[model samples]
Target: MQLPMKTNRITITKITADDLEAYEKLISFPQIAEGAGFNLISNKQMLGELAKRQIANDNTFGIRVHDQLVGAILLYEQIGQCGFPDEANLEISYFLDPELWNQGLMTEALEKLVEVFKQTSEVRTFNAEVFVDNVSSKALLGQVGFQQVSTVIDPLVGRKKLIYKLEL
Candidate 1:
């Protein structure tokens, strides 16, 4: 589904294969990669492979501003091979160009996502994991009505992440 532009200058749309380059750059940033609790992409080949997999997923979306790819948001439908709440319980992950930090763009995009999710019958709640040190993301999630559930030590990144949940 095509989400309405939160700002007149920006458009939020579903992810496509053409977004590979932008996605690579967004995830390649050291800060972004570290904060996301993931290893940095070292080459275009790795990025290509990653993008291919992401594109095949039905839960990813791209966020663009003025026709330029700026970031992405992901909703995880399952954990490993186990089923959960179908689409009723969704986990959200997102990242923006560091240059766009503090501009309220992420908040705007998140608000738009919430608006769209509200219209879907299967989505009853939204969940997010914010790095304990990511103050900006915490604030944005709070602004969007997410309440802190708990903090968990992420073995993958060796950092504690605060889990937040929003009931729709």
Candidate 2:
């Protein structure tokens, strides 16, 4: 709900064009791109454009450690997905630095994000979807109190997808 939301190790802050280089590098990792269900972009111009869009979105946040950008999270509306479109519902998507996986940083960052929203916003639920084989994401969602709500084939990628929801 607020920029620069801090916890013990990580701080959640608004992503800016100044962070473009780091954000691009973070999403450039093949493992992170695949897990986040996006193709790794090879065109510099397109990648920069995409990163700029992310920076411009108010709902997109960078997860930082000691002032260095390590990851990013986005909460937005996806009209036809997990829940009805409204202020009370939003879809969440995130990616972490692959080198930092399994360190529980994402868990802590996500928990703080949810806590802030629960305390400061009118949002009542958060929705998410991950590829069925993305074990870490599923685990992170579960650790943050999200429950599996459905499984369906991802129309864009043809992979089996697991949908999750957390009601607050």
Candidate 3:
């Protein structure tokens, strides 16, 4: 399905095999990884694997600004029994190049994504996990109208992450 591009001057679309290179560049930035609570993307091979998964997954998108790849936004469905309160919800994740920070571009992109999700009818709620130390991300989620529901210490990342959810 082709997602309608919003006025953020970026096209939000499904991730394709051809986008591996761009995805790699965006995730390789240390600031981006740290803010998003993930390890640094070290190589193209890792990106290749990521691209392969994204291509097969229905809930991930490649975000492009002015036809140039900028970042990715993921929406993951909960499986089995999970700690989240809602079963019919999507977990939202995103990262952008550090150079593009504080430009209001990501805010615009996220707003457009929320609109698309609301129209798609796949889920009734959207959620995000932000590292507690990541003030910018917390503010961003708040700007998008997400309310903090809880904080969990991610055993894998060993950091306390704030979980925010929005009901559409």
Candidate 4:
């Protein structure tokens, strides 16, 4: 997947082994976990394992500014809701450095990434699920043309989630 998008002073590239360290640092932040409303990270060893798995398949990417990773984005298929690549509906998720909040970097990166996927991949529908309380994320999704299609609940977080779908 040789797609690296440059937009508004940032580049989004595929996740690699070299990116594990930066990813670990980002995941360790309290704001990252709180903003996303979930935590799949506990310690360095676990993060290393997860990064190794992600690197093996290259389904995700590191969002960078001046070659320093500040975030990541993923566009892949889901099993239960829709289907795989055959459905042409990809689940899109992203997280940025807390310090970069209110900077509009994510909106720029996402707009370009979606544009790239629209042209290069079989993706026709982009799915996004943001926690109800995440007003920033909800605004970003809306800014990128994603419409609220449904409301779902996360049993673990015990909060409502806004499900968005963007048709390209």
Instruction: Give the whole-model CA lDDT for all candidates, comma-separated.
Output: 0.81, 0.88, 0.77, 0.80
Higher-ranked by lDDT: 3 or 4: 4
Worst 10 residues of 2 by lDDT: 78-87
For 13-79, candidate 4 gives per-residue lDDT tens digits of 8878788788867766787766554364566687667667755656687889999999988666766
* TM-score-superior candidate, 2 or 4: 2
Q: Comparing 1 and 4 by lDDT, which wins?
A: 1
Residue 121 of model 4: what lDDT?
A: 76
lDDT: worst 10-residue window of model 4:
78-87
TM-scores, each model vs. reference: 0.88, 0.93, 0.85, 0.88
User: What is the model-wide C-alpha lDDT for candidate 3?
Assistant: 0.77
RMSD of 4: 2.2
Candidate 3 lDDT trough over 10 residues, lowest sum: 78-87
What lDDT score is found at residue 157 in candidate 1? Answer: 61
Tens digits of per-residue lDDT, candidate 3, 32-144, equal: 75665445445668756765786567777777777888878888875536665454687888988787878877788889888776786767888899888888889999998
Most lDDT-accurate candidate: 2
lDDT tens digits, residue span 63-107, model 2: 999899999999887664655657678899999898899999999
Which portions of model 1 show Cα errors greater than 4 Å? 2-6, 40-44, 80-85
TM-score result, candidate 1 = 0.88
